[model samples]
Target: MSDKHSPDEKDPHDPQGMRGGLTNYGDTDFSLFLRKAFIKGAGYTDDALARPVIGITNTGSAYNPCHGNAPQLLEALKRGILLAGGLPMEFPTISIHESFSQPTSMFMRNLMSMDTEEMIRAQPMDAVVLIGGCDKTVPAQLMGAASAGIPAIQLVTGSMVTGAHRGERVGACTDCRRYWGKFRAGEVTADEIVEVNDRLVPSVGTCAVMGTASTMACVAEAMGMTMPGGASPPAVSSDRMRVAEQAGAQVVEMARRRLTIDQVL
Candidate 1:
């Protein structure tokens, strides 16, 4: 009997990239051929296709203003991936926001998680960057990436700018609650309450205060799921875009080293 493995046996440690999780066609070569052919229709060259693939999730929607910076972040991420010699592919996923979701955002968290997991499993990327903000979105992405077991990392959309109302700094539901409490106690007028609504959220992005969205961002960073200082950048700041670019560059290295999700978790 031969002691060495057969040459036909696949190398489990090989970089998956565009070759990962091919569709079942009963023929590995055919499956890969079809995938490459279709992907090439998108104008990918053989040299580019040969590079490591990095997936970035697009969770931006009009209703989810917390992720309004998705387009900018995606662009920065692509720039970083290409600079680092990797292919960046952006994919869409279900996005949930506390203010917009029917009933509650929590009700839809599991569904988003399932979507994230299945998308990662079905894609051909060697590693993925989960771009999320808001309360439930980050948790959902983490849950999904954990189950997918790929080399996955996170990039938060970041917080919003603090606005001033009546010369007082205010942002998000936290300040909204405070004002509402005062309004209920007859300390603030109905007209003033209505006027302050416009100033509460002066821009698009997550809560500026230490709400669930901000909390989850920090948790992801502290848990080693994101780069240092990944949690604090405001959504509209140049720092956030830089962080996204860094995330893209970092994920390429993670793919090269096979830094699977399990390692981080």
Candidate 2:
């Protein structure tokens, strides 16, 4: 590969060995200056920038209830990063929602993956935390992280808590196929179906059962990418925030160790 930075460039603050692929072509100092200029408006101090940079990918959207807890999670994660003495920066990536996409979310997954990969490569960070809850989003992020080859850890937005319908336990789906089968068979009246629908989704989070979002969370845990018990907590639970905080701490350590994604894989 061609050199990411030109030799003999003087940048005392530059994490030279760590920050690869120049932010601005042929001028590292000016690049860092320009980058700091824009972000400084957000109140980032030089001391903060001096620490290791951990990029937190924001995959949240108003349409994605599965990732509804994203802002809270990001806050918790940032707390962990700060506690662990790292600079945490949250950046956006393509968000894929299972129900909202026009041509089916799967069709747009590849595009999301490309967006993830390109953004990761373009940004300057020692490590990254991949936040995703949707089915295709997790895999797309992983695929991108795999290609990006940076130190990364997967943090799930978490599953929704189970709800209750008319004193009976219900799930977040608000629309399971079993209920549809009952409706189609005329076993359930339209009024009852509507009533059940009203109660099924009690809160904001991913589908409760082993749907794509929850299933992928389990898959992520199985793959050794997620923290222990990362797949179990409900999205709105305090435990989920704890998991995010721990992930932030771990990613900073990963950065310190210079652990790349290939090593983790």
Best model per TM-score: 1
lDDT per residue, candidate 2, 129-181, as tens digits? Answer: 99998689999999999999888999999888786766788885645666778
Let me know the TM-score candidate 2 reaches against the reference structure.
0.89
Which one is best on lDDT?
Answer: 1
- Candidate 1 overall lDDT versus native: 0.90
- TM-scores of the candidates in the order shown: 0.93, 0.89
Evaluate all candidate structures by whole-model CA lDDT and list the values in order. Answer: 0.90, 0.83
Model 2 lDDT-worst window of ten: 2-11
Q: Any idea what lDDT model 2 has?
A: 0.83
Clashes of each: 0, 0
lDDT of 1 by residue, 38-148 (tens): 999999887787788999999999998899989999999999999999999999999898989999999999999999999999989889999999879999999999999
Could you tell me the lDDT of residue 72 within candidate 1?
Answer: 93
Clashing pairs in 2: none
